[model samples]
Target: MAIDPTSPPTSPPRDTPRLSTRDKLILFVLCAANFMVALDFSVLNVALPVLGADLGMSQSALQWAVTAFALPSGGFLLLFGRIGDLYGRRKLFLTGLVLFAAASLLATFAWDPASFLTGRALQGLGAAVIVPSGMSLLTTTFAEGPARDRALGISGTLMSLGFTIGVVAGGVLTDALGWRSTMGLLALFALIVLPLAPGLLPESRTPDRPHLDVPGAITVTGGLLSLIYALTTAADHGFGRADVVVTLIAGIALLTAFAVVESRTDAPLVSLSMLRRRTVAWGNLGGLITFSMMSTVVFVLTLYLQEILHLSAWETGLVFGVQGIMAVIAGSLTPRVVSRLGARRTLVAGLTGQGAFMIALLFLNEHSWSVWLAAVAVSLASMPHVAAIISYGLTVTSGVPDEEQGLATGLVTSTQQVGITIGIPLLGVLATTSDDLLSGTRLVMGIDAAILLVGAALIALGLRTWRSAGSGAVEAEPVGSR
Candidate 1:
């Protein structure tokens, strides 16, 4: 007889505590690891031009540098999360850090584009494990209330700060030491995190879960890789190619099979029933849209800055510096905003603001050098989004027990990555199909606005569901939850 994977194994009763010295240390190590992960996400953007020159690659090949990391990380989240639950999160976290560091070293030494991409793909695999385990550790360490709130707040703030600073750091490194050194720095950081993990973090266990779902894991992972490759190929060669069509069909078929398998498995990787939870499903849907809008806009803007404005890599990075500063500020202020506005309202407002900013981009041009407009809009747009993301993360995590937090966080992260991966190609289609860059940008921006508005509407529906659920429940509500 098999056990139900949807039901997490029980541990001793949870003990939530104030920020102990150990808690702070755990936070420090995890944050360092997360910064390195987030750093890799945008760090390569600054180096793409230099890399293209060095490797004799085309625009399409350059995009793969980023996509290779994203697709695997997103696709394998459920698999890694389930593994974490079955084994131990601490073990997985340490393992992931080591793998990530090794991959970084490989990336630093690569002389060819293919070798470099292979390293990045490995880095993504490591991140798929690290991210969920880290989140689960944090969720388990801090119990509900002020302790959990502050821990999550600090974590969220540092992550946003990492995104802001990584670009600058990556640019400076690219200019001074070359693109390879950017990866080397990450390797060094990962090494520093290794020794600290042993004493700082506590191990978590789920002894009752079944063995890892190998069949489901392979199916989902293979499906996502195929789908992403097809989309990327479409961006470069158009969708008319037979290879693209075949890959796309195969990917869809495998994913459909994976879903069917999950329905019958005693210990499925991702419990489809969780999606039935209003908080989980709606939160993920909003995350997908918000991330898509953010990523699509940035994808188009990077090209505009480089091709149209002819800004140096460092200067282009500097242009985004203001938005980074704003993100830090917004991240720090998120808890307060969530407390005042409620999670649902905050999310809806954030989605609306982000949509408006993207729509406004339809008017930007080669004549528009007004950096302040972009900076201000980004800063303002970031505030609500940060607040909403952090709040919703807490809300969803709170709905589940500690052991499953890894799976929960992984699901959310995966959805966000999916948004990012799809954003470029989806918008690239609209942007590049036109004869002129400006026309393409406008068309893509309009699509982004529409998508964001749809997300905002979904959030609005979520708000109503949250209120209705709250009215019927007897438990004291979370501070940010209405």
Candidate 2:
């Protein structure tokens, strides 16, 4: 069927019913939840100095305030994803909201470093539960088609905007009302979302109530937690630190064990079969590369803007702020493009465009013109990210039964978090090892561009193989829907 540019993107299955007022409200709530999760990562960054002074924390200890949140957030995702599948998504999501809000309140009133860290850790746990559950809620509610694509597009946009908003808001809030204000804002957002969730969100779970794979959960969660810790630590201490080396090895061992356990377990936390699916496997690899490189791009640019060009914190925020706006615009338009081009091609275009933009940044310099150019490049880079995120989700969840939506959602979310956790250290190691900061930044950018280009090619080739195998019917159905 030819796509009608005048109408909303149509799904391949059939004409999906137009979204009702209630559906729109539900999308809003889910997107808000996702935005809250994404915002927490960057919002506290600007407040670190003030928070440290207030809590009597050392510079190194202050970094924990961030790491503390990240550890459990990334660690508990797979476990929670399966939990949501067996239990009820609504139940898990509501519990997460309450926990997040309470944690935020605790952080807001914290008088000591221990208290603050505890609150942050709890917030991470809440987020871990919320992200997978919320994503499952989204995928299950929006049928696999253009409607889902559009919904995912909005979700991707909010998530991208959340990070940028956090950067900007952290500076403004900390300056205006102190570091606690950032925590207070989170509390307020959580509180606002908590009450409406029960009414707006629908309950869902797998029909058979599959048995929880305890051993599988333990190995996978432990493995992921250990790996994230190593990456986080490596960002600060380098890859060679004794603890980092030990933890990385341990993470690998446990994950290897996890794969073994899953292959044997009747009710595995992750279905090894899902991993075998071309869309699920390659889409995730594409997502990992996209997130890892995008993060590094931002990290390098932050240093360039602040250290090399002497831009103030607020000025740096403004530069990236423009990029965020572009991301939102790109996200809004993506569903239409996907409707016309198909998800695989859309993903390829997005990845290719991102690489092109990153290559443009290799020429960046201390000149003011370069600053605007860098901003434009970053902005353009985000456009593809929006498409890739939405397409990847569709690719992973398409054809997946409702019972396993949580598992698919969990896998995608875990890949994203792990990608983010490793990006800084992975790229930072290269940049820091160079003779000069500029040289390192250029090298990293060049390498990232190459990786993205390669990823795009791989995805393109995978699509070609699928088409050649007489399985092109799968592509016509939806990116991932059977």
Candidate 3:
């Protein structure tokens, strides 16, 4: 049934409809697509040195290869979400998928740094559109129940799997088929998804969804791009360059203006009133901290493995693979844990475990066996951290109405990307300024520990409100109803 977007959703009647197999397949396809998008980002890291040599890219240019994708994916997520709502989600998702596939094809053949960077940016834009719209589709198709929980669980597992496998696959492809082939493979996958999508995926329900907020989108996108550009340049430019100063100042002013506009607009791209709620505010903030600290942890550990331990790129990636195993285990068991322990307690326990593990890592040295022991420590350490992040995500979206879910999902995604962006620069500074690499590694880990603790504290403090308001069952609700 087409949604009357201007009217709030009426409570469903007595008979809850069962989902068709087509619905399930559609969700699975979209999840797989999203997984590919996420995996390509990190998997490319292992192959960058090779790509840099091949294309004659300087460190700055190579960095842009990564940052270009990230900035667009993060910065325009809110804009894409609003677009999905205003237009039709299924239509936008399909459009994004086509664009993404085209970009991937272009990336596969690119011989120059400029072309590759452009392809990466386009791919990021595609992700920005596809992700939230795909999510919106899932919610509209599923009803509130066990079915939705299972679908979400599957989607989450696919994400974890993607992150785990992407690095390994990227390495294998780079070694055997070449870097271009890896990208070509993604294009093939996207093409496969596109044909199946039209028949399987559900259309957007919002018939009178608000109009596209063009000024809001442009201003916010420009502000985010400027901010990211400034920070990324600062890594090489020492933060003193005139361009950096100008970009930073302009970015701040534009973002400030965005906040003011959001407050005053009748149908804001992002509803400020939604943020005023304690759950949305605290939950997203905690998520931001969690992702930021996690990004730093990965950065520092990769450096430690490669620089100090003298491990090869493939070997370093292999070591990090243990975290993926741990994440998969945690993600798989999350539903059961939420059922048994409740969301609040589960989140608390996960944060506590992660923070403790990070603190213990501060004791390792160049000669110590603790470095080898790290594999086991990290495996255990990743569980709670991943679980807590998943838990907090569950909390934030529980309160969002379906029409605005795209916005909610976009906000979370944006927050995470922004966190990782900030974490890279801050932690990079700490690592570069230290006397030795090991001390720098320790400082980074210690800072990660502190950040996790703060995130934990926020989760703990927020638990009271969540428990009183109730948080879990809603997230576990059927995708159709969400």
Candidate 4:
């Protein structure tokens, strides 16, 4: 007879208030890798022009340097996430570190346009492996409740800070040491982590291993790849382009096929049944909305500050510095906040506050007073935005059993990646279409605010503290779901 892998993962015990040295080491290793990935995501942005000139990449080809990293990272998450569970998370994590380091080296030494894109795509592949594997390990290592919440809070904080810092670092590094130095930096981080991760991290797996669901994996991976490619492409070229339209259609068709395949498969790559869990369902939606809207806010503001307001890059960075500080503040406060409000209400309150502040940005323009207030509002919004960012991870991972932890986290991380990937494009197209850049930006912000508030309201009405089934889900009423 075989054991049900859904039962709690074997461990000494859980719920200890203080972490042992080993526990801290585990957290450090995992959180550091995630932080590096977050940093790498944006570190290339400011360095893109310098990098392109060195490699002779054209303006059209330049975006591919970024897109190359994004495609595989967004596409293969579901497949690799489940692979880690079926194989070994520790094995998968270590392999990811190795791949990441090697890919970084390749990008560092990249001599031509082709080589650079290949290296970036490989780096993206490595990142796809790292995120879900790291998340599943973290969730399983610490049992649910405060312990897991706190760990995720810290993890979330570092990731947020990494993105914020990466932008500034990209500019400074590009100017100081040249563009390749940015690539070298990530290689350094991965090299440092690769050797220690194997020894420090505990290995865990699904006790009852089932055959890999090839059909489900194929459809989902293809769908996501196509969809993400389309989104990234549309960001640069308008949606009217033939490639964008065709890819968009193909992506939708593939995903619909994936759903059908999953329903029919005996051992699906992702357990569709789990989506019924209120925690899983609402939680993922919340995660997607929070990340997308927040990232959109940042993107539009970057344009408004630099292009519209004609602020220097340094001044723009200064205005948004408040966000980085709040990310740190939330890390320390999240555990206490979640402990008191519970993940459900904490997410709602965080979203509500974040949305409110987003609305406050609508007043922003050339007026000195409005500009000052708008800057302050974004900083104030950062508190709840960071809170929402951390809490949503807790909400999604809360009651997921060990067996499905990888898949659960895979879905969660996919939302995180896709949310960030899509937010700019989805709203950016809107911003570009408007008659005036300022009004367009303000319009985009208003729409973003509405989306956030509406999402928060839905989660509030839909999620409950009380568990109806042994499963984390309940019959959530849809209140302005979108």
Candidate 5:
């Protein structure tokens, strides 16, 4: 029988497949890669002082080791994401792993600040490719609904755990094997993962592959780099610094031009129409809010625990270690929560819960008992953070085609990095403005809580509208359609 070409195409029913051995192996490799990238972000923090001393770096110059990595990692995300979509995700993923490993090796052997910084920057570039490509692989491998949800839950847990692991690992490695061990460990991990990836991961690319959007890529990458640089610099140098102001303005102008270019380009790096989708738009916004507030909490707590309470680095790591454990447990439970309440409602509940916990931080003080209370508050906060992360990821990627999964994941990852970059400076300024540190901490916590609540409200409203529109569309369909 010949099918009529004029007939409307039917959507495929969402199906969940049982995980086979190969499937499980693929999941493990992807999660491990995600963990490595995330771990790189925080693992160096504990080693920074010792590493700097060994490299003869001054106090101020030491900060660039972090900035060097962060700038390219965040800046190149979108460009690489689209590249994965156009080229091949598996190839990009493999390239990222190899590059990251080589950079790690270089850093391990670096004899000076400049050499180490070069390695760190290269590692960042590799991570820029790894994260989105890795995520695209996950989404494409697992079918939507239960399968993708479960995979995302595991992936998010590992990512959150990676940060905690990095903190603890950095301390232990630096103390036992010296600062070089930190970079060496990363190199070792990358080498272990590299060989397995080629056999385990599958290749994927868009069907109607379009030409690369050079102009859009250039403008967006330049813009994000400038913005991130300005944000980070403002944390140490005042916002009024001439270079910071100039860079900030240039970033804005370039980003505006990117929007214009994307709107008119034949093969756009980011589809403007995708941003108009409710889930992608609102989900990214929610992610932005979650990461910014959560990161600020970490920054403020670090100061409180160390400076005000006079706790050692090990003690602070222990406190966060407990929080990280809770985050993993929470991430494990997210799939169940989503099954019960759905992604939108889950997101709202998670956001609200996190806000409530942030409000509880208002009572924390310098007393020993207060430190325990702070730990408890942080532990409780992790549950919602994990929930929100998984839910937002699902929401953003839910209906997107496999071809654009890289782009979608890129947006999510980019917002997360941007949030982290902006949060420290934005909230740091607030914490510094007050006369007293305790008073400043309280003020910032209050503001963070408010922002979380506002974000929840906005998401809840968006969900309501989406549901209403969905219902209307359904009702308009013919009764005998099936």
Candidate 6:
């Protein structure tokens, strides 16, 4: 049965629905698809030097390998999300899967920088469709309760692990096989998931869903593209460059125009009122904070280990591999934790734990032993970090109507991608401003921890209001609703 946001659910919020074998297979297909999307974000990092050397890309131009994927990926998310809702999500999902696979193969076989960059950009465009579509599909498949919670826990775990594992896998694959193998691996994943999806996942067929919002789509997509480009460019070059400055202005202006257009349009691309909901607003902000701060932690620590501690790429990867292991453990246990404590409290506590560990990394230095200490910090922190990641997803999708799950999940997916894309640049800029690399790393970590604490406080306050207003469950009534 479909659900409306304002009305109470037909079933008990915490009731567990039994999953059939078919349901389990559907869950696997959806989560695996999302895992592939997450893997694309970081799997190419260790291969970049090799890729650039082979493709004749300069140091400045090399960043484009990653940036190329990020631009269209982040930019077109909302547009494609709306399209999936209006058209058929299953078709969109298949299209993205095929596009991603083809693009990955293209990048794998490219003989020139132009071709490689084109392939990467197209991969990003495919990712823009996959993430929101996959997420919306998952939510709509299972009702909002215990079964959905379990599925989300698995999805969140895989999503977090995909990022950390990508770094390690990139190094290993680049060493064993050529750099091309990394791109080839994603295409392989698509081959496996594509066949499963077509047979299993249900297509979107909401009768009351609105028509395409052309003006809203144009303004928002333009705004996101400009803004993401500015951020990605600013990471390498400062914000003062002519291109960066112009894009930054264009992004802001276009987004502001988008807001105005959304307000006046009969069929808005994104519902402005949805953004005003206590859970939707604060939940997305929480996701952005967790993803940006935690991901920046990994990056800053990786650089600190390599540059200051003189650890090799292999050693640095080992240090961070512990994070992936701990993330898996934490993700598996999160359903039980959420069952005991609601998503609201779980989010707050998770932030507190994650922030505490983040602050502990401030002591990192050049000593060899600091590597172990850093590893410990990240390992312990991964539990709560994973917790925050899962809980934020649970929180945001809790009260949304079934028809708008695409829009709701789109908002969160945008935050996750934008956070990954923006974190390095925003914090990397701060880390580099100081002449002392170690000091700059610590400065950024400290700032990130502070932001987490402040975010936790604000989110708690927001959820408290939501509870007082009679919606006791901050997320789904199910224990592992993420």
Q: Count the backbone clashes (under 3 Å) in each candidate.
A: 0, 4, 10, 2, 0, 3
Among residues 3 or more apart in sequence or in different chains, the pairs in candidate 2 whose N, CA or C atoms overlap within 3 Å are 398-480, 398-481, 399-481, 399-482
Against the true structure, candidate 4 reaches a TM-score of 0.92
Candidate 5: tens digits of C-alpha lDDT, residues 252-345 = 9999999999999878999888877777888888888888888888878877888778888888888888989899899888877765556666
Which is the winner by TM-score between candidate 5 and candidate 6?
A: 6
Q: lDDT by residue for model 3 over 53-101, one digit each (tens)? A: 9888987678788878887887788888878877788999999999999
Angstrom error at residue 20, model 4: 1.2
Model 3 clash count equals 10
Q: In order, what lDDT does every prediction score?
A: 0.73, 0.85, 0.72, 0.83, 0.85, 0.84
Models, CA RMSD each? 6.5, 3.7, 6.2, 5.4, 5.8, 4.3
- What overall lDDT, based on C-alpha atoms, would model 5 receive against the true structure? 0.85
lDDT of 6 by residue, 197-255 (tens): 88898999457767788889999999999999998899889888999999999999999
* Model 3: residues with Cα > 4 Å off, grouped in runs: 1-20, 144-146, 235-238, 467-471, 474-482
Q: Tell me how candidate 3 scores on lDDT.
A: 0.72
lDDT of 4 by residue, 278-301 (tens): 777888889899888888888788
The CA-based lDDT of model 1 is what? Answer: 0.73
lDDT per residue (tens digit) for residues 1-482 in model 1: 21221222232212233577877888888878877787778777778888888877788688788778877777777778778888999999999999999999988998888888899999999988888888888878777554665567667666655666777787999889998888899899899999899888898968576777788889988887778777767766777889789989988998998899889998777677765566677767777777767767766766677777777767767777777777777776665554444445556767887787776677767765645555565566666556656665665565576667777877777775676666776777777677888778778878888888887886676545353121111121232454
List where candidate 4 sits over 4 angstroms from the true fold.
1-16, 368-371, 465-482
Over 331-363, each residue of candidate 2 has an lDDT whose tens digit, in order, gives 888877766666666777888989989999899
Once fitted onto the true fold, the runs of candidate 6 whose alpha carbons sit more than 4 angstroms away are 1-18, 468-482
The local distance difference test score of model 2 is 0.85
Clashing pairs in 3: 141-480, 142-479, 142-480, 142-481, 143-480, 143-481, 144-478, 145-478, 148-478, 148-479
